[model samples]
Target: MSKPSILSKLNSGVESSSPPMAHPLRQRVPSTAIAGLGRSLDDLAADSVATIDPALIDPSPFGDRLEYDEEATNLLLAAIEAEGQRLPLLVRPHPKIEGRYQLAYGHRRLQVLRILNRKAKAFIRNLTDAELILEQGAENGGREGLTWIERALFAKEMEGQGHPSKTIWTTIGVDKSGLSKMRAVVDTIPDHLIRSIGRAPGIGQPRWQELVDALAIDGAIKRAASILQSKEISSLTSDQKFVGLLRALCGQSSLAPHSGRREIRSSEGRSIARLSSTAKGDVLAIAKAESRFSAWLTEKLPEIYRQFLIEGATSTLDSERPATGAADSDGTMVVISQP
Candidate 1:
């Protein structure tokens, strides 16, 4: 499918070639002309279109998007530079701050214009909190559209803003059942972790719910977060980051096929542990040469785990009694992370 611009359907009614300075401002096209009755993007009147200095405009208070794709954004920048900005952004006069405006949509266009050092063309409207969010949702939903998690996060944001469920459902283009599932996932997981995971557009609702269910286990949050904070986590793709955390939380082995052993190295590049994976489980063998370190690790296991339980409680879903980890017959210890 062709990518949609920020204006979406509104671009059809908007006049091309910004008129002269003395020209009359373009009047608000009727809602019916843009979207038919009862559409999410409809009803908000865009009273005028004007060219305003990009410096005077501010970001939207109710943001619906997480982040823009770099490739897509660069494409937009190139298009605007070559053809000039064809679509106008939507903004409202700042309610409290003087001589300032708050954006409703078209953030990408505005940012690109700022880079190009050009003024912005915009649809000016005074919108209520509900209307502002709805417009934000409609513009996004109508345009390139949000990923599953983005829609869920947007639903949570709307609810926090005091918008009714009907508005939330229609705006995000989800049914009641879908909205309930979204709320379930968003409410259970920490927003910080979800945001850390990024849009994960390839991830679907089933995988999200699986993450949620895993988070319900005792010490799961701290366990998952430790993995997330690990150096390897940052280098991983969004989906890989999520799957790793989920596996850690559920105490499940990696879903990937067994690929022999991978080395666990110390900061100085010495091999400290050898990790081998199987469908049934994984084993971390402390190097025989480092007997002192292995003994230290064994002695510290209980103390380290005590700390994990105490800390995990803070981020735990509910009050949970500390659970014990399974050990090999030789009694060597395996741990998620050391405190």
Candidate 2:
């Protein structure tokens, strides 16, 4: 027997002579089943992974992360080299250029692929600017995550680009209060200072607020400039550099003497004490000493002063008293009367 055509089978609403498993009855299929099939095809299209040349993929114009750890990147590169890329990156078709794509996230992975001279496995989607930001923000938040200052700067950048606060909050996975605090840090801290500090990963809102308060003091900017210019600050890691700057600012006020007294140094030129001429008396301020000698000196000060006083009085008596020396029953005696 000849097989029936698919169109004729659909039109006649009849089962085909072919086995049930060989040909599905189109007429018997429900509208819901057809819809489900269409959805499955759409999903497959959306989820299909493709390997594309790294040169064709441009970084997201709205990328949030500013700093990447060298060691972490090296580790990632080693992993990809040994185990291959386990996850695919998300990217959108380049809006302005043909035959190009823009990354929404997975910048590190893309960089590794480029360095390896290999193609990037990515999920291509048509994304709007808002959608791009959302996807980028979500991926970053769910992953290793941006530092506090990084997030602050990102929020500020988004605001500068005219994105609303609600959108930014959603993207950053923060509430209104958290967004406000982040913005406050970005607003209060100077741009040069922030750039000098880099991304302080573990630093939080309170420490940032402390930094802002420190910056409000007079000469803070100059002090911060001096700190950034120092070799020690330059040698520190990003997080350590931030902490060094903060310590410099906070310590500036304490290091300056309130009494306007000059510090006194020991014979070795170490500042061991300070001297201030006050209306009531000459105030002698000793520098903080944590040594055993300091503890011994503190304990023996009273006895030493008492002995000094006794020696001074005896010397005065000897100098002023008349020479009246007589041999007593057992020894010589000198009786000196008070003048």
Highest TM-score against the true fold, candidate: 1
Q: What is the C-alpha lDDT of each candidate?
A: 0.73, 0.70
Q: After superposition, how far is residue 171 of candidate 2 from its true place, in Å?
A: 2.8
> TM-scores across all candidates?
0.63, 0.58
Worst 10 residues of 2 by lDDT: 330-339
Cα lDDT of model 1 by residue, 34-56, tens digit: 35333423433324468999999
Cα RMSDs, all models: 15.0, 18.9
Clashing pairs in 2: none
How does model 1 fare in lDDT? 0.73
Model 1 Cα displacement at 158 (Å)?
1.5
Residue 10 alpha-carbon offset, candidate 1, angstroms: 16
lDDT measured at residue 96 in model 2 versus the true structure, 0 to 100? 94
